[model samples]
Target: MSKKLNIGLVGFGCVGSGLYDVLNRSNLIDAKIKRIVVQDPKKERSIDQSYFSFDINDILNDPEINVVVELINDSASAFEIVSQALKKGKDVVTANKKMLAEYQAELIPLAKENKVSLLYEGAVAGSIPIIRNLEEYYNNDSLTSVEGILNGTTNYILTQSNSGIGYEEALKSAQELGFAEADPTLDVDGFDSKYKLVLLLKHAFGITVAPKEILNVGIRGISEKEVAYAGEKGYRIKLLSRAEKIGDQVVSFVAPHCISDQHSAYNVHNEFNAVVVEALFSDKQLFYGKGAGSHPTGSAVLSDVSALKFDYQYEYRKAQSNGGLKYTTDAFIKVYIGSKYVNAIEEVAFYSVEETFQSAAYSFQVGWVKLEVLFDLNLNARKDLSLLVLPDSIQTEKGLSELIEKNLFIYENQN
Candidate 1:
């Protein structure tokens, strides 16, 4: 049995409202929102005025509020609210991925110091129970790779683009449908997925990596040309976030990949998300659910609230047990680079070129390159190139020759 929860909700936006509704309507938990805090008091909302507070201290200073749920848009403000609440010995549930990604190492320790649980299943993959599973089940398994379509907005846009709509039109549709924000830079540029990936790295590999260290490329650069190529090759363009352990080091990145129909991610369209966890004896496992939306994300938040009732806290057992596993980009990746100019491909300086194709519309090459080279290219802000990571099977010379000789590799001229 758990104590009745008095929650101080720190936002009235989509997710906050959704949580409030579910908590009030459902009989799943003994929780109620004692007070709600908002930045702009004048902003029209569905709730009564008396339930809202203009000052965060109203909730932070309240002794009745045993739990703090932070769902604000600004990462800095969310961090402040969560940290203060934790210092006050209040259990916290937050959906601020950027904040957690940036300050998880510090925040996790703070929670332990205060003897309070800091849970953020809502921050990662919306409704997917990934963080909890990684903490509970996969922690004991020898996980080789954890990859998925972690961003709903980018996945939605890519789904629309695959249906023959242009990227701008797809983005506009996503925005209009509220699947994306007015300023969708975070989602479209892959920063959102990268933040989630950072959290996944911590839970999955017991590694703490800076979000910037990963090579994150979103579907923003994916033109119809790539979409056509994917269709021609019986593949779907999905923004994939992946972290794989190679030897003693772990390599992670977020980018657009050509997923075949056989892949679990191929059918994960719109606001859906999927995670593929591959382990030694466990083989492969998939977790799929709504990646974003008011109810979907709110359900995750409510679950954390319910968890807080029984004093559920992430043990971070893997982080404590795994030793000497470092995050690195000093790896070789098989990739397909498509660009309008051939020089852009040459500048990558791939260790080996497996295939090259030239045509009037675009030029591309499939080869192996040091992951650091691509990371540097991104840092240098080269804007004209689109890079796609190829599967590991084609990394060898024999496999590359077989793909080319069998006419399996798709090129513009070949079509």
Candidate 2:
């Protein structure tokens, strides 16, 4: 008979507790939770108090523990804990995207050096298994683009606000329903999605660029007028994280986009997430599932733990390959710029103005503009301005497709 794997769990919050419950109820894997570390020992929990520990060393220093699972909120603390566990030669699993996005360059190599597994299936889109697919199925395939709705809180709020509910009220409803935190800045401000995009870059294109390098705009500035305008134009407003290979550069960004109902993203609503991977031979493949909630996220984390039983680890072949891919935010694109500050939108030179709408409260214009020029404008920084959506245009779409094909042909010929 196989020996049971001993686990040292960190954090007793939503995902941690859910993982404990799942482990207790399931008999699929021979695993046991030996210890749990949390911030507060006095805090009430449904699990037995005997399992709780105030110090992290109890888990990190314990020689018997074979696996360490970190699911904390603070990225700094998470990084420290994960680093320590890896250094101690314990296989590690975490659901913290921010820490991974920021420190993966250092952490990934460390794990490889130590020959310890560092798996994070719960980091990107919860319960989707997108990471595993990227590492396994698409490893040999030449991918052109990866785009998706990556956040549940903003998606839920956008769905509510588009249905005539006010923005503030929609946010309140999300908070009450436990879909959002009290301070929803990370999720609503696009930082959450940006972090996920950074991780996606590593797996999709074998690139690791900082979050600040990408153009990340959120749904916080989306108003009723913008939502109504999207509806009228046969589009749905969605916060999308997109990375596309053009020439030798990968254009990546996370922002609210106006997608037509005919598009697959329009069908993904509320707290659900969907990822579309476009490859050379595969064309397009969609991955959809519940993106948030304790059970869903916990299920992903448990999958990583189960994989450890068989000594599975991410190969990260693309990252190690000489892909010669570069990251850039210098693409020419089309966008809907809206604000009470009309002068702000008019400051840049547009290729062509598609339409213009004005009201007592705001003014908006749809036009073709260079992404770098728009990024220079910094519309997201202004309280009076908002870059509403990045919509697809016939000219821009055709141009990007051609560029992708040209780049792929060149890559193939060179190899």
Candidate 3:
């Protein structure tokens, strides 16, 4: 606790380099500890020679290193590395949201059993401080719902397209700006948001739901008609990660939503991510900032290091006593086969709410129903089917304040 904390870096990638630079910089915290870069000696693993290097074994065996900072992006070795470090009695910090979200139940218990802190401030919202903020400030107040634009690549693409640019132009601009990944599949297809949602589910509600439970739908299907209509109606098209406790069940998804100017989510344009969490106190709070990349995300990692080096004594954490939740899927008013499954089931279960009764939009099922009924599901309907909770920008006249107010109010008595 006297000198700087020793950092054992598992990967020398962009985030790893930012961590190295932060700890070593003279003007900042004046950290005295040095970071040792653990490399696969068998691989080229090109990095500055000045960085301390040894086989992965050297890091696990080195008693001098009391903290392990994991920046490795893959699941295979990341699992092994963090597992080994916790067993060795070292505190851990990581930015691998994908691995953390998928294997949290497997490792969180291990870290707790070993009396070591497994910190992941950099895993979500980059520099937004969303994770610990909810974990520390909103305990016991029933986080009834949490939603955000969690992936920057999709956000950037949608934001750019909102200005009249097409998806191709927006994607190219995002790639050029470094907001989109080179391959961009995970971020574009909503896998990245799904991974981040896993972290939110665990941290916000103490619900250890897997990424698969919540439907993951990318923004690729967002149409020009939708965007143009939203823009005209005073809304922004964003790939929103929305989760809520509906009636007796919890339901979540990643999809395009039209948010109004009244919501902060509409302001989170470009690569920024924003979260609106409904707490038990009947409050809906907003946290916003850049969602990813080297500097900002590394800043999140450094914040964890600073906490370990100076404040772990005061940090309080509590895992749910029961620690088990059955996933919720009961909110399905309508169910259908996806468009991709169109060849399988021609007719699907389609319900028109009291609010959307006039439009008469019917859902098609590729695998679940007979080929004929797809034609008449919407023919019978009331004129007032509930508005589909579409984004504000998309539906100029629609409002979610009633639903949002309902969600926020549920927490008041409980908090």
Cα lDDT computed for each candidate against the true fold: 0.87, 0.85, 0.67
Q: Rank the candidates by lDDT, best first.
A: 1, 2, 3
Instruction: Give per-residue CA lDDT, model 1, range 1-415, as digits (tens).
Output: 7888999999989999989887878897989999999999679989788899989999999999999999999998888889999999999999999999999978999999999999999999999999999999987788889999999898989999899999899999998998898988899888999999999999998999988788887776787777877788788888899998877778888888888877877788888999999999899989999987788899999999999999999998888787678898766777778888878777778877878988867988887777777777872245688877766522233444565566554664588
Q: What TM-score would each prediction reach against the true structure?
A: 0.93, 0.92, 0.78
> Model 1 compared with the native: what TM-score?
0.93
Indicate which candidate wins on lDDT: 1
Winner on TM-score between 1 and 3 is 1
lDDT by residue (tens digit), candidate 2, 215-305: 7888777888788878888888889998888877788888888888767788898999999999999899999999877888999999999
Q: Which residue runs of candidate 1 sit more than 4 Å off their true CA positions?
A: 379-381, 393-415
Candidate 2 differs from the real structure by a C-alpha RMSD in angstroms, to one decimal, of: 5.7
Best by TM-score: 1
lDDT of 3 by residue, 179-246 (tens): 88788878876788888888887677566777766656566655564565567768777777776764
Model 2: lDDT to the true structure: 0.85
Number of colliding residue pairs in model 1 = 0
Q: For candidate 2, which ten residues in a row score worst on lDDT?
A: 389-398
